[model samples]
Target: MSSTPAPAPAPAPAPVPAPAIADRPPPTFRQKAGFFAMIFGMFMAILDVQIVASSLADIQAGLSASIEEISWVQTSYLIAEVVMIPLSGTLARILSTRVLFSLAALGFTVMSFACSLATSLEAMILARSLQGFFAGAMIPSIFSTAYTMFPRRSMGKVSVVIGLVATMGPTIGPTLGGFITQALGWHWLFNINIIPGLIVAATVWSCIDIDQPEPAYLRGLDVSGLVALATALGTLNYVLEEGPRNDWFEDQTIFRLAVLSAASGCVFFWRAFTYRQPIVDLRAFSDRNFALGCFFSFVVGIGLFGSVYMTPLFLAQVRDYNALDIGIIMMVTGAFQFSVAPLVGTLSGRMDLRLMLAFGFSLFCFALYLNSFLTAESSYWEFFVPQAVRGVSLMFCFVPVNRLALGTLAPDKLKNGAGLYNLMRNLGGALGLAVINTLLVERGAHHLSYLSENLTLSRPEVQAYIDRLAERLGDSLAGGVAGDPELAAMKLLFQLAQREALVMSFNDCLLLIGLTFGAALIVMPLVKKPRD
Candidate 1:
């Protein structure tokens, strides 16, 4: 009676056709230019971190700084970068990409010029720290911009490109630094950055652009978080920078700084989580893949950076290799690493990333253990074996962990992942260097004592060896002469002392690397499969 009219036949349900797969748009020419320019800038920034390796002695001599104080040159830059990493995302949102990158390049160039002119240790440290701030902002920005330029599927190839670009830092840094320091002086180390920085800054300004951040996410800068972070990192660096000279915890000042660092570190992490607007999205931890990848990445960081820092020290100082010679040795491993990047990059997607990582870690542990056996008379080939194996391991490391970290993450989470990755890597490097440096000092002293006791002149073997050396010299048995046996025995004794010292110091460095890699290897099986 209501005359429903059968509800108009309930309009036939609309056909539910299958969803369409959208074709990705091609990259614009401007994008190509910006992407490569950013790659170049990133190369230069990373290069700066290690370029000073060969020039450390010259810089120390030029500035009248001691071995202990000279490390500030490295520490200052590390400290600034550490502080800026968490802030990279926040700053990226606040400023347009083009403006931010250009400003960073400009500031970095200016700071390099300042470094060239620095006449005092303090001045150089300040300049290096300022340069670090700019470099810090640019690294994540470059990675973010480049990765987002293409669709997700294209990330593998892009990662290979980035790994190659990044490899230039360690590969060329020592070689170029050697040539610059030898041909010119240490000052040229800073001066060379000026032209490259300007070229990249102009190129980036013309090519890159990004729209403003969403207003809702644009919270005020977290100054409290900054203060807490700075205090912790800065305090910790103070302890590391001074520990070798101050005798570690025995020094009251270093003790205080260490205490302050631990306390401030805890507080900063707490406030960062509880704040209205956190500096970094610590919630990135909610993703299991990201978190686990980061854990392994950190151990890898300690192995990579610590070895880089310590090996050069031993080569330059202990082995008496000029920077050029050091460059030649390092080239062995660098070449090995460069050749393997593409393979690892491609294979990571197809194979189980965890298996790949575990294999790499195993090789790393084996290499460090081999390196621990180095003596003062060790050949280049002897060291090269372990180093070259590590070089192969590094390829697996540089690409796989990064891809795995981002595997299950959404697009929006990438920037946060990169930032956290950087910060943790730097921290690992700092801890690695700190522990190795401390142990080298302590262990070297202990080994010397043990060797002296075991190899006493009163021992029959040592006395016989001394007599044989004296007899070979064919000089008066009782008196000293230019080539006399008494003088010859003394010389042989001195050589043995030097050998013991070198072996003990290098042993300590290897111990650090071995333990770190071994621990990571043991924990590898715990990383869960892709649940997403």
Candidate 2:
């Protein structure tokens, strides 16, 4: 019966691709070494920024540059680095991981030499900018390699390494830079990169054999998209870094740049979605876990980098601590994180990542809440425990966050996803730093005004305190060894008021950071556990 030949059975649905994290062979020794070499290079690159940060004073004096010009040493690097970060994915595709990383390491090494030899502000800034470009190229490459070179079974362990390197550079940078500068001099900061850079370059060149170059991709490159992205990231970073310094939108330059950043960002996103082969496939974000994971990552940056920035600043400005002392205090956080990393990595593989993330954020909130109690008289002991909590929290946060972000990405989209993930983290940090700085200034001013309003001669308590202070200084004033008694008392009152105001501002800042972390928890439900 030719009666309507049985409709051909619909072709079996194409097999759904599983995440790469399933059971797999362990990485061989050479693969491990090569991966480590890439990580080391990344660490060195990230460390360079913070190392120079601690030694900027020396660099300024050595080069005899003005404050504005000397600031470019950092500004230039940051602008270049931010611009290059998102582009790294496309660049890697064109050059291949092995070739791209090798060139980056080599270029970075040469630039370090150039920077060390730089004698003028112009020379140093130019060298630093170039160095930053190469160094920025290496960062996402390390992240991408971690996913590509290792199996899913090993990513948890890889997360441990990535977290350490990510945290270690900023955490220990000031300490290392201080020691190096004191012992060897500021030049050593740049010179130190030479040997390590060469070794990393050589090791990566020899050991990394996978991922052949797809030079043809370069020909089809999204030129307009690249420009839009560069403008968006570069201008945005410049605005964030310079806004607090320049009073934000009040400065015409910053305001103009802000507009440019927004316009370019819009263009970049539009092109990324519309283009057949966009520079970065924003479509990876369609995965619910990845989108939520990135949001968590952004919050992580706010907590991680914000704490690093605020603590040192408070120690330096309010506590009168030296760079080395501040670095020492900050190192405790790094130490705590390092100690717990292996354990956290192990647990992440066995536990629900969402729970780990929740626990981590809770710890961050607790630490920040505790930190909000900081007083002008607070010492290293006051910070030690909170810093330890923060360190441990970082371990818990990074491993699970990374797994959730990249676990579901298709192999082809892994690099692009990593780039965007990293960009969000850095953006969060920049925004946090800018907002915190502005809050410190604005909140401090508001607190000062409020505190000052009640501090008047008409108030009995105010008058009483002034009289007491004036009487105490009377003997010295009579002998002419001290300044005017009335003036001295007024000075003392003003100093006390200023101190109180600053303390309040710092507390408010800490509270805000804590609340932000707590609020981020609402996104937790969006992440799904990896399928077995």
Candidate 3:
């Protein structure tokens, strides 16, 4: 009994003191330089896609490619990019962040040069796909490092730069490309990456020195999981890109791809849950904040990419603005994002993130509503305010949503979580663009039919408008307007009807976008706030 009492009376161990804030090691100047290089690489990757947008016609001409073949230039790049994004997490783990980032930058640089030198459509597509693959590899690293490389207190500051680069690259790509192409020729668009890419590669290789490779983890590589994930994302991306263009399920290829995507996705998830070391960890979704953050990310992606797609289409198609002018108008949105993102990031440190999300979504919805009023007569001035609102709202949406999703994960899970989080946004963009395209076609047709039905020269108002248009044409054109007045009037009426149909369709699309943002707002409360 005495022995047991003596054993029980062992003294308590001394209390361990928590490390003070000042004791934490800060990032060195070299690491910061490496980060900016990574940002530059990411910027180039995203910007390349947009830069090529304004110059695709020239590319088509230079390669002697058909319109259908030219579309593959973009399709190939996008498909490759999407497939590589999620895999980056696993790749980084195996190769180490430093090596992976350096290789990605180098690969992207070489591909960009190859793209510039491509002599045929096939060559261009191949190079572009390779470029996209490497580019996608760089994206998740930027965000993952924002959380993993830096301290939590500095995340808002880090995110500001990443968000700005991400937001601006696409936002201003067309404009920048237009200028480069105009001054330096289309080949320069790809060649332009040479200097910057070299700089980035050198900086990344020489500077980044943080992550350590786990050779043991590579031994457990999930081959089946990798193939399944690639199949799921690749086929899904193809379906999204081609669905509306091909009338979705009506086209056998799209239908087949969609089925493959679904099956592959099911298999991937099953593997994720059952495998001892699956490539991806689906368990991350079980976190409430991550799940809801992803939900909202998908919604915001719709607004982000959808608006980018829509506004340019509106400017080019409806207003007949040149690529440069369209780019300039869209830059209004980017300008606001660039200026406001830093401020928002600073405020994020001190403010209630939920309230910020609410405000952001509200402002975005209002911008969409404003866009709903667009007409054939709408000009840059008309888009200016809405685009600015949209720019600010983007910063608000991304910063908060990013914090919510990945902020609560364990450090080990950061890479995987970042990959999945980004994948959702890209998928959302793809799906949103598809839906918007389908909507434009379907709604435009519906509006056309309805408008045509009432334009029989039966309505007096219709006749009067046509007569007035004819009179104006007669006054303006030489040789009595070249056709019979009645015939000309009818033709003009049809044109007007078509334009009106397009405007109505766009308005409908914008309204739908607005409603989607509002829905996202409704889901905001599901997220639990993390400590600052």
Off by over 4 Å in 2: 1-19, 475-483
TM-score of every candidate relative to the true structure:
0.88, 0.93, 0.93
lDDT of each: 0.74, 0.84, 0.84
Cα lDDT over the full model 2: 0.84
> Which lDDT tens digits does candidate 1 get at residues 400-450?
676667656655555666778667766777777778878777787787777
Of candidate 3, the 10-residue stretch with the lowest lDDT total is 9-18
Pairs of residues clashing in candidate 3: none
lDDT of 3 at 414: 67
RMSD after Cα superposition, model 2: 6.2
Q: Which candidate is the best by lDDT?
A: 2
TM-score quality measure for candidate 3: 0.93
Q: Ten-residue segment with the worst summed lDDT in candidate 1?
A: 13-22
Instruction: Output the lDDT of residue 275, model 2.
Output: 70
Clashing pairs in 2: none
Better candidate by TM-score, 1 or 2 = 2
Candidate 3: C-alpha lDDT: 0.84
